[model samples]
Target: SIFASGTNLDVVELWFPRLSDEDQMLAVARFNQITSVQGSAMAVALPGIVETLGTLHARSYRLGVATNDSTSGAEKTLVTLGVAQLFDAAYGYDAVANPKPAPDTIQAFCDLTGLKPTQVAMIGDNRHDLEMARAGGCGLAVGVLSGTGTRESLAGIADVILDSVVDLPDFLSARVKETI
Candidate 1:
């Protein structure tokens, strides 16, 4: 069963028994193939995501990825997508004792980037991301209608729901300008 909790931030918890080493390897291979295909095919950034990340990176805002995937898997995905350098910090399950829903990975990212939790925003495509961000005390929790996260799935937990990542930069820029 899938378990989840939190509001404006949620934890999506999947209950799966530990995989055997062989199964893990198989899972990784399948994941790699799927991710490689998706990354290679997406020639454009998700509407506003790239611009936001790029703008933030250029402004020296600490950028990080806290994921439940393995380190190698995350690295491969980022590299394949040609966005590895955008992140100032990256944390995966292998990099921490606990993964999403536990908050360890996000906490590790905060530690590595030297950013307070309130200075960070967690953008994700799932309930797990929302939960993790909330648990980690992220300032904002944004859900994208990408991957498997549907509007209903991300409702309530997300402070803002975007159609794609492409909207992020524009949204953030507007917010920052308003604050200034």
Candidate 2:
């Protein structure tokens, strides 16, 4: 009955397929309201996040965000941080029928970019992120310790674990050199 793959919103549609569109709107509004409050305190970007994003962009790597947060909310945060233009695309829970761990969002992203799953890497700080990467057949599942997920929780799920996204550029560069 209940799936533990993703957030409550991700499974809400599965459980309540009969829910009226009006009711779904109300639920989304309520969730957005709650997130708005939480987002107030999170307007600021995490340390090294901007630099890492900029560096990744400069390296010609296309970037996209597959967040469970509302699209508007994620966009607002990115805009506020001055990195919105650095991203090629951003998908929220509402963008897909099923969110992370189901791989719908990841598939959508791949389709949009005309890239295969094997050409992509999913970098996240949670099990859902890693699961989504795996389900989508992504080449890499990278876990970070910068969010709520702990090392133990992300272990075995992620192909590699890092202290934070800030370390990603160096890690990727090293991998490229190793292959050369």
Clash count per candidate? 12, 0
Q: Please list the C-alpha lDDT of all candidates, in the order they appear.
A: 0.70, 0.82
Instruction: lDDT for model 2, please.
Output: 0.82
lDDT of 1 at 69: 53
Candidate 1 per-residue lDDT over residues 1-180, each given as its tens digit: 132222111111122236665765566566545644564465354545566777878877677776665465566666666788998766765577777777787778777777788888888988889888899898999998865688998898999998887677777878799999
**Model 1 — which ten-residue stretch has the worst lDDT?**
7-16
Off by over 4 Å in 2: 1-24, 33-41
Position 76, candidate 2: lDDT: 73
- For residues 1-180, what per-residue lDDT tens digits would candidate 2 score against the true structure? 223334446455665677798986677677666664567347988899999999999999989988777676677778878999999888877678887677997889889989999989899988989999999999999999998678999999999999999999999999889989
TM-score of every candidate relative to the true structure: 0.73, 0.85
Deviation in angstroms for 2 in model 1?
7.7
